[model samples]
Target: MTEGRKMRFAMVCSSNQNRSMEAHTLLKRHGLDVASYGTGAHVKLPGPSLHEPNVYEFGTPYKTMYEELRRKDPDLYKRNGILPMLKRNLAVKNAPQRWQDNAADGIFDVVMTFEERVFDMVIEDMNNREQKLMKAVLIINLEVKDNHEEAAAGAKVALELCKELEATDSWEDTIDDIVAKFEREQERRILYSISFY
Candidate 1:
């Protein structure tokens, strides 16, 4: 463990509904300091058809989204897993937060993104920011599918990564070793870069 406090973590994905929330819940349940965000213009969920999606602003409450989707099509939403996903999201956080909006709230030791696009956005955002703290942060991209099953599996892998990271006091010094071990064991390649707060 670190000398001062536990490491802080952030999980990011496209809409912050499925993948990020899944990992967020697992990390939080393990008593790790963690937060999750979405790198999207708006929160989106699947609707009755492929072309139409249920889109809401960033600050819309999960309960409100759940009720609206349920009201719109109780059977369809339930069958498609949107209702359950919203309920799980409600348990984790009140609303979906945009990554750019919340990036400056505080410093995080590690920021994990679920997709390559989100990873790129996070890196760009970090590079654009004025580094006030000079604190080093590791931004890792572990591509996870947006679906429920893949999210659950990805969350488990994320939790394992956190466990390995927390085992060392100086993560920056040992991150490469941890990543190499994880990749060898899990057969999943991890893309990582260092940024500043």
Candidate 2:
């Protein structure tokens, strides 16, 4: 809550390979403390295809991602999810579980869900007070559909929503903007929430 103190953010995505990974990379580039994970546990790389019945081969390695992140900004890695790796390096058992539980037990200042279903899941877990104090931002995915125009339109809507959210101080304003935009666009929605605990 102090000025210049980085906010702790958790990004929950349907898959950690593409959209969520890009967002996480961007946020980290901007010097925010962010950790991202997929809803499904231990999802294999080269995920299922959208257009065809084949799996997509373009995927990133988790360990390589971690190491690359650490090398880029050690502090970000330290505050994000790298502490658990450090513990593991020291031969600590339950390092992953400990770090994960610490993260989930109200450690994150904000929780952002990238997909609508994941957003709904996060919303279902929130209490009244937490909901009131929290900030939920939806990052609508443009790549879901193959149409370039649709993707561009979806990205535009998302940018507008983000601007509206950034401009207003009231949660109602955020909610209204989201609902109105989504209703107008009638496209697939990906929602992310940030909670200050």
Which candidate leads in lDDT? 1
Q: Which lDDT tens digits does candidate 1 get at residues 66-127?
A: 99988999999999888998998899889988889985568888899999999999999999
- Write down the RMSD of all candidates, one decimal each: 1.6, 11.1
Stretches of candidate 1 above 4 Å error?
1-5
lDDT of each: 0.90, 0.42
Over 4 Å off, model 2: 1-9, 30-33, 47-61, 64-110, 127-160, 178-197
* Candidate 2 collision pairs: 109-195, 110-195, 111-193, 111-194, 112-193, 113-191, 113-192
lDDT of 2 by residue, 1-197 (tens): 11332345555555323334444444555555655555544333221233422122223344444565567666755654443333332231111111123334455544555456766655554432345434543333323331223333443443444334444455344555655665566554544434333
Residue 137 lDDT, candidate 1, scale 0-100: 93
